[model samples]
Target: MAPQRVVPLSLRKPTHAVCVVGVEMLVDVHSDVPRGARSFEVAGSSGLEVIVFYDPERAREPTGRFRWPLHAGADVVVSVDRASKDVNDLKVKVSYFGEPESQALGHGVLYLTGVDISLDVDRDRTGQVKRSRGDKKTWHWGPEGYGAILLVNCDRDSLMSRDRDFANSQLGSLADLQDMSPMVLSCHGPDELFDSHKLVLKVPSSDSKRVGVFCARGGNALSDYKQVLGPHNLSYKVERQSGEQEIRFYVEGLTYPDADFSGLVTLSISLVDAGSLPEVSLFTDSVVFRVAPWIMTPNTQPPMDLYVCSVVDINGSNGKFLDDMSYLAMKANCKLIICPRIENRNDRWIQDEMEFGYIEAPHKSFPVVFDSPRNRGLKEFPFKKILGPDFGYVTREILLSGASSLDSFGNLDVSPPVTVGSKEYPLGRILFGSSFPNSGGRRMAKVVRNFLYAQRVQAPVELYSDWLSVGHVDEFLSFVPTSDKKGFRLLLASPRACLKLFQEKREAGYGEAAQFEGLDRVAKRSINEMLADTSLQSDSLYVQKCIDWNREVLKRELGLTEGDIIDVPQLFSLKGPYADAFFPDMVNMVVLGKYLGIPKPYGPIIDGRCCLEEEVRSLLEPLGLHCIFIDDYLFYHELLGEIHCGTNVRRKPFPFKWWHMVP
Candidate 1:
């Protein structure tokens, strides 16, 4: 077949290329398509260069061309050369891309404008509280934050006095954190309407983007009724960035009904979005907000282990309050557990069994327990039946074994006693009572004392009190003198009352020697700081001291000195009444451990926490267990002997000796 013949350009041929004279026009191309369709060849000489369109799907490849200086009736014609590849076998059209140029991007061109508004209340923003900077050319967000009205006079370079003060009053007080200054858009002052100016409002986002909108008075800012906006409205177009987000606040007729007001609206350009964004606030003004995808935080992989601790089954009117005691025991390791009360009067032993069962579980122990009835149904008790082979039984067995000491102190040795039925099992004296600040200090001393005994402590248990609540502060203060036994009642109340008492005593002639003479030297020092600085009086000195001590003890305990400031807000993070219970000894842990630094042969307990059976295998991998089999004075050392021990054989650590060898 013969190739198509090319049409030669001549005066008889239609001259111009595709010209968009009216709404649209068509141009035809012959056979071949070209690789680079750079310029078009038109028959007629036209000075103007017009844009050309190809198939919309393939925007970069234009099949044909067009001519400019188009009139309503003009039709464009293109001369396709056979040598050109791009123009072969195609047709194209030309037309106006968008609306007419008379309208531009928006309804009309916007000019420089400003507005004035008023506030009805007193305003405060940190240091700038008393002073009004209305006529001040520009305002800055102070170190703490800012508060103000919604008006500005850029032309005069000053704030309108009355309107400025009114705006300030509406601002109230600036907070120390996020800025939530509610700018006064417009206000009615008693009788007259003052809608005579334009306002410059800076809409700010937390992400530091700024949007300045000109709000005119008697318009949306001050108008009471809905009004149609003129074509001369602001024409700012924010092309959405790849991940940019937006929240719009609508002012009734001024803004679309649906708008996002998640950002702060401040007169000052910088701090407009410091607190809540104007986008967020617009919702409060009868509009809904839609947040774009750009504003969201990137997603992250979820955490694996949360490490929570919970105490099981605290049974009592208020004694169960220690349900979260495990929270304290584990420190920040996990959350606390809440358990159901086991109240079978006859099956009291079952309750004991249940308590021991939980103690043996892998999780830490909490002081919460279920209240039980007197001895009636022992065998049929539900608590005992909870000893499933899977968990409960093993836990109970572990507890029983741990409590089974050769010289372990039992219930018989207790003082002040455990009340079983009508029998008072005197276990130990109430050394101190840490009052509960919540409810009446109901049986707090008795329950804690019993718990201590159950945990294997024989006598003299110290008690902590919750002194803050509605009542019972004075009652606890009275027990300060006589209960100063070992681990006695450590008064863990708010530092407020403690400082007040110390101050009163100090000013009245007697210094530290006046009250609570038995308190340790550190406690005395804490009291001194509290008395000296009135500002620190309300701050919980005891809690602070505990935190300081904990930091020190943890440093010593973990052998960490360089990065020692790990645990903070110690009391707040710990769970339980005795969270502050161990505070007295926190400072002493370092002092005690310093003398025993890394015992010879690394002595028994490796690391800090006592080794459990599960962790023993891994730990033995590095340093084999130091076991000594001394038979009739002939001693032999066995490395990793625990691994080979028989099922019935018990593993024990070897005594420190100079002859020990390194792994």
Candidate 2:
């Protein structure tokens, strides 16, 4: 290989600064000066003056000598002419006092402009300049004000790194630097802050150029850039120069109104020199800021729709379920939609007669319907639609088209639809009793899974064994939305847990011992009833197994622990035979946003009153949830229907976006 050629270098003093127009200032320079040089001349449209100081000490008077080093590297101070106009480009030439020969420094230029730029790194906690590679800085910006702008000045060769040995072998000229004109500056930040298109540059106007402001894209930038821009929009132009492409943004028509932006934004600025063969780039430290209109998800938003049926009368009063539901609708400020029972064809009129359960979703053009339950008729119930939202009319068919041959016991005991996952990405899940292994089980599972996939819901499908007469997940479990980080917590009905709490209360000599005694007696009687029924002895075993399985599944799938579960007092009674068996299950409740509608237990009254409601309230109050008693005993509990069976909730569909799914 031939001997390697060393590239020349250029250096300038006062690397960066901000100065006003018509201001005279002294700037220093250390370049390849000829032997016996005496004077120097300043050139460039910036109109700066060049007055070489023979005594470096005199040049260091204005700015302290300590700050302005006068040494072999920077020997002379070039003064800005008092009459010089505001410009961006300045150059220097050195000459000998006795000789006429003068030579320009090897490609060195001082940037002098009217634009005011200041950098506040780390939110003003420190003003230390980063000197080492990979040193970073940060700033916070908002709609009220723009982020800081940094003044950067460096040599063209230093800006680009190329292997000279390989470049010379390729036979290409490496001295060309003018192509790097009009360097591009950009920014990157968090998506929660400003729009991805957030890098902005404000250019000043002069006799040769007009003032203009431009912007580009940023990383993790906020969504809805057009909305953030408000009435003003961004326009772009593409230009081809020196067989290269240059994309520039024009912001003359753009406006930065205070109302247009909000949230925390972290931003970094980068300078791109397009002149280099592969382009050269430099990045400044990052900055973070808080903008206005910080959008946040509400702790508990009100339910939008409720699903109720008139097939079964709750609370022993026939033809009153709809009226009771209508009252609930008014209180919750939501629309009530009725699912007429197919078994009672005559009840079809009840759908029109009822004055609730009818309303359109926010974006939906027509009223939503809770269609008749498939195959199993009214027994399986229409609440099964709770599996997921009907994305469109076609989704309704998918929800209703499931296995046809559901047994009477299986049909009535299908698990109530349970929703899991965050409010932003809710997943609809259901539990089926393994004993009721039928075509409907497989078909419904597949349909729900496909529906969730098609809708792009980010929830997983899970199953838990069911063995009780009312073999429904809702009979023993529920979910309540919360402001906590987990978004919601699991509500489980555990007779064991309830008994333990009551026993502890009794041992502590609490005033409610008599009430606890009655509750405990009722619970033991119910358990005894199950153990006595030889036909359900096997079921009793399955029930315990199912409970354990569910608890573990919830912890694994929902990321929940024992602390996340809210246990409600409940008991199972097999008194009236298999079909008549019912659970005075307090966990089988209806959720209307922040209000939890539960059944008022009508078990053996103690001390001339029932304290089940009080006990349940005491358990829920600490979690910031309110309880509403729905006197659902005679018509619902005795008839195998609980609060969840007699009533259903059609929650407000989440406002989901593609980007919101990202952690």
Candidate 3:
């Protein structure tokens, strides 16, 4: 914002006073004025009232000559009744000591028009308060966007309490102040000038429900800093005691933007002329703030924490898988959190229960757990354990529309940072699987989709997922990091690619080689036996078509070419009308930076090596990724899931701020 123009003030004794038109305010320096000017007198015309402040006694007018050689007295302040129009309608004159020589020189009159006041904030949205110049009321977008940002106090701040900070009317602890955004109020002038005027901060009644404000009084105790403006409190009187010039305030968002709240809340400060009959506002300054939205991290982001559950039942136990995950986490340089059987309640599908996300602001940020409405054994796990200090939790229940297999968060996915056409998604775009439009079979709950769209940063796209029995987006596709212009590669499950690998082996004289060579309780098939099964071939072809449809959708939406995608060798078997993975799905892997935890496929062994694993390593290892295959067939695959379905990951947020985007 630009700075307000300064009007010149010059009035002295034994000479003429310089007259400056469009003068707003004037102040008298006791040292600058000579003792010859015993005192000064102020008077205004019909439309104006000249109010002067020379003494501390109840803001009286200039009934007598205000003292000039004020011994240790405050500077004199003069203000006019109203702002001057194009024509200087209300002329004000001030004469210093009517001496005989001054009579020959005529009256040394000081003309005054108006005493205007101004308020300013971080109008440029650079986290610094500046002087108001242009467009302080309207907010704009783009990289050159102008406005402030506010963070939702939705995270727990105090260790003693689990309640979200915004819910508590009073602050829980002093540390709670860190979650709020900062605002500065500057009213700099002679201290005595405020005796005839007052500064008032105001918020629209509608905005009170969305924000709460607190002042930082110069005291150590919590009681010294009180909430000055909030619910039911629309205006606050700024108490600038004595020589105080600047005041600091903290603002907290009470709720996220939704159907009711537009997410844009504005606060204004006004200067009121109290000496007037009705007291009028001379000037008002307004600045806007937008509430931050929750954003989900894609696979390309480096993993910070790994989450998995341990369960023991009649089917099997995940003891071996847990050990493998611990080792992988160590290699990836991340912390591993294991959910015990007591906490998991035999629910190992943690990815289906919730998705990890976060809300951010310039001042503070925190991770948030988005709980799905699946309501399984791990339904309350996130709320009970993860909703702690600096970690937030949010959820939406499918009340009228009952939950389905597609309601699981495993169907939720987001591509790596992509640029489609001329537009770009620096935080990546959200991708979720659902039934075909008008199919009426099953889809993710509408309420969940509404919440995601309200976020606004990541645009969500729908894909066909009901073609499979356990329909999930992770079962067929994922993304991994690579050092290229695209920064990542989309890993897609391909039955055609798996078939080609087997055909090459058969032609190389490995026709008798058997899948699951040593594994028991599971049927084994020779390369020639699998090649002769026409029914299996037809099923694989149908699943390939389904995956191809999503492949096209992804390429179009993510602006990807065939070079940016890598096909993982895997097949599926038709079960009734839907399909399931023929082997442990290799594409559904846990990506942690350069380390990838892939599900081990018990394929035919040739030259003492699993061909499927060798093929996957060849495709991914060249891109600087480690493919660590684990034996998940016994527990996870048999239960109709893979590593990605059972495990969850919390990755680092994007470095690019969300407010910079035009959307």
Candidate 4:
């Protein structure tokens, strides 16, 4: 190892300071000595070791005393093995030799004690309750990726706190401390060492606003944690009581990692020389922590609970829709939660209101719901009803500018865990829609988008979705779990596939069968009539081209081949330049483990079974997925929505620990 520091030992008087065990300090020797001095002699007590090296081939450690001829380039190295329990217990002396003993220089006394200081964190993804001395700086991903993990104090554990715990600097309640990570400072030395020297725990000015620290002053009283180090205060003079060996502090992240910030905050303790005019640090021990990112669970994770809204609007009633959902929930054995009309205010689109995510650390983990800025009927539902105890609430609003339809979370979805080439998205990548090439169109709020991008773990991929009426990603694409080669498959709505299916049925002598045969007020047309209509034909082809563009992007960005994607037979009608589902949209379905609740596409009854229903059943059944078609036509399909738009699911988090991955 290299020397801890370098000091110029003055020959005029004794120098007093503190020393650390096993640390080497190089002393500048043979400088400013008398011109005719023939030799130099150096010696130290039992606690200290002295080394004299002037020759490259041979370096000597003098056990008792060292005497050397005057040389131009000789250097001295000194170290200590034991601490000095009393003042002036250890001393080193240097003398100059001239023609007579009367011309010799006086020796200086160095009265110092050696102290061992260590600052550590959990390099493995486990809790450091047992005090593991692992690397606290470098953070990477994989089975060998090592670093300490931190969770943002975003949740309110105390009902007395009106806001999230991180928002306030003062300690509001005792329960709020459960959201933070623990850090330990181990200092070992003699009791008399601190009588002249001092230690400082500090944070750089640049990182002061990003983290908060609470004192662990060993007691049950809430006032014991009154001292907090954060944006207002950057350093703390360590209050080391007599015989105190170690001290602990609780660290909490104040804000999320952003583009300007890397989410890595470091805390350091410096041993300072109190006797100097402008204090100088003798040694510094630092530790690094990476704040946890908000992660979204994909549809593949096992569903824990499902949510929906009940409303009797001017156009439709969701009573039947609720019943069908209840049946599917029973079949999947998942809990069903329905928001009454009084709370929903006739707005039935629950999926567009909010998105579900969570943040985790080595010691604690909890769910966090991201409320959208779209102030609909369920605008206050997430904060007022869902946020309680360990559950968290987060929101980003376009305060200066109003929100657009693209701001709805219906445009947000995440892919399953994927291995793209050498890169692995163990938590999957986030997918959302925007008008990228066409800047004149409506887009998601920049504030919301920036919040998503700051979560460095799941890199987000943007897609163009402004061509539709609702401009949501759920209208055309979805993902479902399977026991096949990829473990899941991407389902895309393809107009060309629907046309091909109709052509095959027409060629098979079923041209007389019509679509939407029993529905009231809905246009019912046979295969021959639909195929011959040139206006519908051109719109179908145009819609197919738009979907094809997204298909290419998804395949390239998600690293999927043609075999990994399954096309659902769907047709669309053009309203001006925007498109919408002509019948019931089957692609927008609710996924729960291996069970799926799909929209009932009312096609002609052939062989006593609906052709479109059998089509979807044939595509997904072979992969061990159970499809249950629910009647969401009257309430959702006609309203430009489907099952997924009317329903939402909160699923279990990924089994893999996020700290193991390097982003």
Candidate 5:
């Protein structure tokens, strides 16, 4: 083939050579130059340099190089003018070239911005995460283990743009590329990871090179990353970092093991690039994880295991009462621990100097005794420290005395503690009556609540009428354990039931009015006197209100139905004054495990019935609880005391330990 003649540059169109720099390189082209010109020079904008190279051996190679000004994602246009004679200027177009696409090779640099790690212990039950600087390498967890959260923030520009498929694939491939990835996080120790055969955690992802194993030096790997996140159900999303694209990593779960896991553990975290040729890697300081010792408060449960009461030998008043209580304690198969009288003086001093009410044995103090787990003997059981308000009395024996507080003539501020519970939670609540300033007021209630909470005891306060002669909760209500499905039922005083019985008896022409006709004037006069007293009327109103309030409280708070309540019939009466008057009381009974000690209802005969003992038994027998009617009127009830006032019971502890359950 014949060679084509070379055209003269000055006679034909002007040729151009373009070089683009400072931006990405996309294309390069060089055309053959005309043979007539020895050398050519091109000129353009400032801050640019052009170099021309001439080599005789390589005739086709471009002889010139130029540095041009370029912006990211913007096109660059070059105008080449012919310095030779008689030639026109030619315009050459250059493509745009910005930063690279690879995350490690992009214009933005990857940096470890902020790291947040939190440790939570279950013993405190606060669910608070303690922030750590991660300077320390060792951490401690409670016996029930703990929960944690780790946050890793990366520079925004280092992250790829949003592409669901690409992101998912990268996350899916993480396991395979973990060895080459930049960061590794893990926990190491016995049972370090929950429910996994291998203690190490292998976070699965599409791009293992992007996210690798995260660990602390002494820590073990997290078990089942997916399972650990099962509770939180975490999700990922793309975000901006410093005005640039970013990807966030959020991992939360229960990381520590149970009490069985103890000793030192290392949590190591490291970062390194796994790109074609990586040059950067980072490692975080290790943290410590320690398992603390298990501790818990011992609370009291019910079903009386031991009976505690003081024996008073003053004026021989409580001798028969003591005998009856002892016999009842023996019948119930409970250990009777009799506390001696607070006054150890002679009988004359006790009878003459001390008030008759002060001789009441159980009035001295409210003893809450707890036995240690290692102790099995009842005699060695020690009393818990006084938790409630302190009464200004000489001896600690009057700590919870109900004498001054209950008497209407004295004060109604100090409330006597009454422990009660339901079938769902036996002996779980310590019930207290509302107090006035004269009694132990709201301050006492606050102190009691705070004390119970501090001691890990759960209790609730209930409202009761202070207008009654004896403003004690035990005067109107009691709790008895039953063999029924409900486990326990509330015993309440019902004047309506007594009135109904009296009316029915009268309709049959054998009521109290008809049987005891001679005592009618006395009863009628007493009723008139009670109605005349404004304080008594106020007391009646308060008593009705208290009954209504308690009914609702029992139903709502204790989860009790009408069937779970047993109403005992009794009528109100006035003897002398409001303080000295005595009303027919029945709910002031004692609970001895499966036995119910009730007062023998001694009053005028009605429908051939002189006493309601048989009726009371009939009403309670169906509930699967036995009843024992004792004559407490002579020594106890008549003297302004009830069965509970003369006795107390020390209960057994619940079987399950508190530490075993989740906080």
Candidate 6:
């Protein structure tokens, strides 16, 4: 094994005041000094001084450039301090076997490698803290601060066991050492701390140079280099010839160590003229820095020639249709091009619609996310030319070049039941027609009823209907919904037949069998009356007159005076049916309670108005019910089904308190 080299990372001749250029002060020696080796000490108030040592045997007056092997089983120590002239500030002594000094000066570069840092627990162990590297460009939460002891590697092997053994063998000399674990240090200043976390150790680079040991904390006799590095199975030997000059270096079996270097750190040694000469000194200075990792920002503007056509009913708007297609593509693990273009009348519009892809920008949105598709470039599709006359006249082909997601299909319908395989109808229903009464209870009931009728032959499945007309619901429930209900086993005839029956009945003026006007009429009835005989509640009314139901509940609950009429239809306009349901519950609890003479909480009594009343809470508690108090009825599924509250509120509020039921 070649000698392991050690460089002074920082150095300056002893000056008026003690200053360290490379690493911090104290240096550790691995073994006892050999006979005839000279040690150097500085004592003075001079501005700057240098330490020079050399062997006349190797080359007289050691100067300029020279390399000496760091032999195994050798240890060298260098000490420096502000020595006063009165304390016999300087002294020099030379013995036989130790040669004369040389005078040479030329700068040489060193590269440090094969370094190791390890951790170990102490007896009656006290805990040590080390920070782990964090994510880039973001602040991170920190743990409580703690001190870490230094542990260096002696055995330079990859396997931790060898290093442990080497470290243990050196533990005997470290009795005063309180901890044996390696100190993992971290840069904590607000600046980019990651940069300073690394130590760039430089040693005279050579194939023979095997490894080096280092510590930020000063090394003492109590510090066991072997115990700290025993498990590594590596070693370093340094000998000061001719009073600490011509420092000999050597290495044994060793391995590489891990480093999280994010910053630039400098480590170098200063060359000098003579060995065994007076005024030999040690210098140290360290540079600290923070580093920032590279980051890439995205182009925020939507691409030109890309326009989004939104299809609302999963049936017409191109925009809506595209959304569904994107969803399907995602499910199939298919990648697609983002920002596809769509023709609007005569002008081409590009849409930045980003909802389709993964969104990383906190407030930014994108239509598609993932790897770009296999092809690129804009394409024009002339549906008539490629897909035949079945395709419309405006045919333009979308040219895809390179990897991209954009794909062109001559006006192919991509809506429901469009499975990848199914022989009967290779392309399932692609055309989406317009729907009336786009929202609300009327829309909901019609959608549900239609879906139910379509799948009448199958088990009655809940139609996952949002808002749609009665006719569409009939078609959906009877056929489509039933087929997808997975094997519940109840089926009904086609939707067309059911729709005919319903229209015929309506024409005959028979009306709903419940014989009710609409939701308005149903809401008009007192809560007490509805609760007493829920059979009187009507589904048709709940569907047609939601405002009537809403206003009636409101009037009853608030005790509206004459001429206090509210615009029923306009007041109830909102997007979600679920939210609409909440308001009705508010009416139910407050009005019913007021009519039944329920008392309100007395947190407020200003100006004759009890402002902070809990009347709604008091009334709904006993029935395991709570009013949303917003303009909707959001009863739980169990209550909605069992109590049939919307259609049948015949039962009195049940006898339970709000606290009695566990949420």
Model 1 local distance difference test score = 0.22
- TM-scores for candidates 1 onward, in order: 0.17, 0.42, 0.80, 0.93, 0.43, 0.19
Tens-digit lDDT track of model 3 for 472-564: 999999999999777999999998998899999999999888887778888899989888899889999999999999999999999999999
Model 4 vs. true fold: TM? 0.93
Per-candidate Cα lDDT values, in order, are: 0.22, 0.38, 0.78, 0.82, 0.35, 0.22
Supply the TM-score for candidate 2.
0.42
Order the candidate numbers by TM-score, best to worst.
4, 3, 5, 2, 6, 1
Q: Which ten residues in a row are the worst by lDDT in model 5?
A: 354-363
Which lDDT tens digits does candidate 1 get at residues 1-663?
A: 111122222222222221111112223232221222222333322322223334434334323333222222232333221111111113222222122222111111111111112221113332122323232232223233223222111011112322211122122211100111122323111111112211223322331121223222222323322211112322222221222122121121111001133222222211011223332211011111111100000001111111111112222132222322232323323333323234333222221222221111011111111212222333233234322222111111122222211011101111222233343212222232334334454333232234333332123333232332211111111111111122111122223333444455457644434221222342333334435654343235544553344334323332334321212111111223322211211110100100100001111122342121113223222222221111110000011011001000101111211011110
Which residue pairs overlap in candidate 3's backbone? none
**Per-model C-alpha RMSD:** 29.2, 18.1, 10.0, 2.8, 23.3, 27.1
Residue pairs in clash, model 4: 14-109, 141-661, 141-662
lDDT of 5 by residue, 56-165 (tens): 34333333332121211111122112111111212322211222221111111111111111221111223332333333443323334332212111111112323211
Tell me the tens digit of each residue's lDDT in model 2 across 26-72.
Answer: 44443443345443343434454443344544443333212222242
- Candidates arranged by lDDT, highest first: 4, 3, 2, 5, 6, 1
| Candidate 3 clash figure, as a count | 0
For residues 379-426, what per-residue lDDT tens digits would candidate 6 score against the true structure? Answer: 221111111111111111224433111111110111112122221211
- What residue runs in model 3 are displaced by over 4 Å at the alpha carbon? 1-121, 130-134, 189-199, 237-243, 259-261, 272-281
lDDT string, candidate 4, 601-653, tens digits = 88877877888989999999998999998888888898899999989898898
Query: Which candidate comes out best when scored by TM-score?
Result: 4
Q: Which runs of model 1 end up more than 4 angstroms from their true locations?
A: 1-131, 134-181, 185-265, 268-663
Error of 2 at 135 (Å): 35
Candidate 3 yields a Cα-based lDDT of 0.78
